[model samples]
Target: MIRRLARFRQRFGIAGRKVAVRTELAWYWRWLGILVILAAAFALAAWMYETGRRFAGFDQRELQQQIRELERQNGRVRDELKGTREELESLRAATAASESRLAIERSAQHKLAQQIKLLERENARLREELATFESLLASEARVSKPLSIHRLTVQPDVLPGEYRYRLLLLTGTGRREQQFQGRLELVVSLTEGGKDAMMVIPEATGDAAPAFRLSFKYFHRVEGSFRVSPKAKVKGVQVRVYEGKAAQARATADATIE
Candidate 1:
């Protein structure tokens, strides 16, 4: 029996030899390998998602900053518009005031012009009046100091056989206090019955009513109307002034009748 067991060990090739052995893997080990692969894939996907989230945060911050800058620019534009409106209102007010002042100045200028014209006219009128007054003073000076007949005039009266005469008798300035009383007589030449004849106006028909009486200090105006014969045509007149109701004449003047 020992001899036959030794023969069997030798025949099975395990008598004194060392050799390696292999066996089929278990099912649970295959499942564990698959779980490890899936875990590695999940971990890679999580790392990619974290990187993308960081990039997105940076982009969002930049966009917010851009929006804030746009808002600031809009506020500045609004302020500029408000200031422009205020300036426009100021300009309008100044223009209106200037126009009003200009209108008032124009009105004042027109009034001044009218006043100047009135003053000029007044000056001219005053000059004319002065000239007329000076002329009168000159005439008075010329006739004031002489004892003479300054003027004589004669004219036919409205009556058929009458004549009128006028004379200006001037007294001397040297004898102002010596008052002179006188009588005036007029002598006229006429054609009566185809012959020259002489007649006296206001003749002394009676001593009670002498020729026209005259009394003066500086001057006297003598005037009279007298009648001649109806058949007489008067041609000339002579005036004589006598002193103090006397027949002796002091002055004589003559004029022609038209």
Candidate 2:
């Protein structure tokens, strides 16, 4: 190795070689070459850095383009987010309105039910009151002769005085009785001058009824009445009540006549 360096120095015209080469002189030359290359690379890097600084504002258009793209994307995202929020709020409001309407309907239904119940109660009460009134009326109904006589002119009387009479039959039945129609028999007897006197049968006879349909529980049950002129001064009278051609339900002993 030393011989090789000596030979190299002699060739290079260095009597004493300041930098000696190793025995592997090829390897050393390559390493030295690499170092020189590295120094050249550093110089190039510095030159490039200085040149780029001088042209610093040249890429403004590209930067603006990138900024515009980003801004567009941001705007699109904001619009979409705002629309979504609005839709959600509208849905919430609709739901609230529906719920409020449902509540109102429920309240109305409850009130209607209450009103129906009240009406039913009132109707029932009214029906009961009407029934009570009807019962009272039925109980109080009785037969009455509120001046049941009418003066009728006839063709003849005792010595020749013609007189006629009209008999009206009124029923005093309670409210419980239904109206009826049938025959009625009213017997006519007489007493003259406050004494028992036989009434002479008149030449003409009036209408006579075998029986009468007397409403048992009505206000006015007029069975019927017979008109007769006995041509006697008899003033005493009597009356009897029967049902369905059977035994007497009521009998009148006697009554003073006017």
Candidate 3:
């Protein structure tokens, strides 16, 4: 009986077995608790990350604001530059228009001056012609010669070595019954290379010979041009008129060049 009692005590003794006390929970409640702990850890990590960024002087909101302000400034500068370019173009256009108008005005003025000069020359020529007619009417004596030359002139033309000549031919009262058929000749006296020289216009057998043929009655005006060596200095010119098949000149006039 003692043995049996000892065996029972041993089986129930604390040294032989330790007992655990636990409260039973549902599976859902256990999962809920785990999720709550995870959420708290995530919140703490986010807070720490934000705090570190601030410590490092990297404020995202301020940086974004500065970028927007710079964009606005850039837009304003672009607008001003565009306006300046437009104004420059406008000024250039205005300047071009002004220059064009000035050129036109200058051209008109030049043309007006040229017309005035032509009118003045015409007036002088008319006055001289009127005086010649009046003198012819006043003369009582008839000319002895059948053909006579008057008012012969030789002058330098615009170009070098070019000369222009003009003359008036008057037929005597008896010669006016028939038209005078003749030819004109020019004797140009010049100095070249320190030597005296003479040249004849409308050289023999030249194409220009046709232009020297003359046909007129009463009074006739003769005008023509000739060219010579540019290096030569002209001294004097003489004009001669020849009738058909005549070897000698019928009329002659002399003019000195200055």
Candidate 4:
């Protein structure tokens, strides 16, 4: 019986040792699991920090580029504004100069118009005086006792070679007159005892005044022998306007060689 009790005690001691070893192993396993979870959490936090830093750098670069573009745009806008101001200034100056020129021209034209008006008034006055004198002469019912002229001078100093003598006879009331009925008569005799006489140059028909109009406008072509005279007192020009028996000569132009 004693021997059996000894064996039972040995067995109990071995079983108690086994249970203590198992408890130690369970505590070690629990500590290892806690360490692995802590390591995983730390690694995740580091990765998150790196990723956030990279993202912040990218955002900063983009913001800097946008700022540069805005600054460039501002500079361009300023330059454009300056150019527009200069253009406006030039336009203003041109406009002012044009207005000044226009004003000066207008002033000059006003003065010219005033002078023209005065000259017109003077011309009208002279015309009125001439009309008055003609009316006075016409009112006097003087008998048309053929007006007559004895001598007429064409030129005191004559030029050399074959010269021309245009005789002009002007008379009558100032109006477009066509009062001539017959032919004109004139005896052109030179101081050299040479007589060159002609009634009128027939080809000068267009030059004749409209009918009886008082005008001495006529063209006469006389050649050398009759006109080229060096004689001291050249020719006596006689112009008779009316052709009737009662002869009235308006005037005559005579030439003298000095």
* TM values, all candidates: 0.42, 0.32, 0.65, 0.32
Assess candidate 1 and give its lDDT: 0.75
Worst 10 residues of 4 by lDDT: 217-226
Error of 3 at 140 (Å): 4.0
lDDT of 3 by residue, 150-169 (tens): 88999999999999999888
Per model, state how many residue pairs clash: 0, 16, 0, 9
CA lDDT of every candidate = 0.75, 0.51, 0.87, 0.52
Worst 10 residues of 3 by lDDT: 136-145
Off by over 4 Å in 1: 1-146, 205-211
- Against the true structure, what is every candidate's RMSD? 24.2, 24.7, 6.1, 14.5
Alpha-carbon deviation at 192 in model 1, angstroms: 0.7
Q: Write the per-residue lDDT of candidate 1 for residues 89-178, one digit (tens) a residue.
A: 898898899899999999999999999999999789558546644553367543454457755778778888877776677676565677
Q: Using lDDT as the measure, what is the rank order of every candidate, best first? A: 3, 1, 4, 2
The stretch of ten residues in a row with the least summed lDDT in candidate 2 is 145-154
Q: How many backbone overlaps does candidate 2 show?
A: 16
Candidate 2, residue 138: the lDDT equals: 50
Report how far residue 155 has shifted in candidate 1, in Å: 0.6
**Cα error, candidate 2, residue 52 (Å):** 14
lDDT of 2 by residue, 140-160 (tens): 323332111111112223443
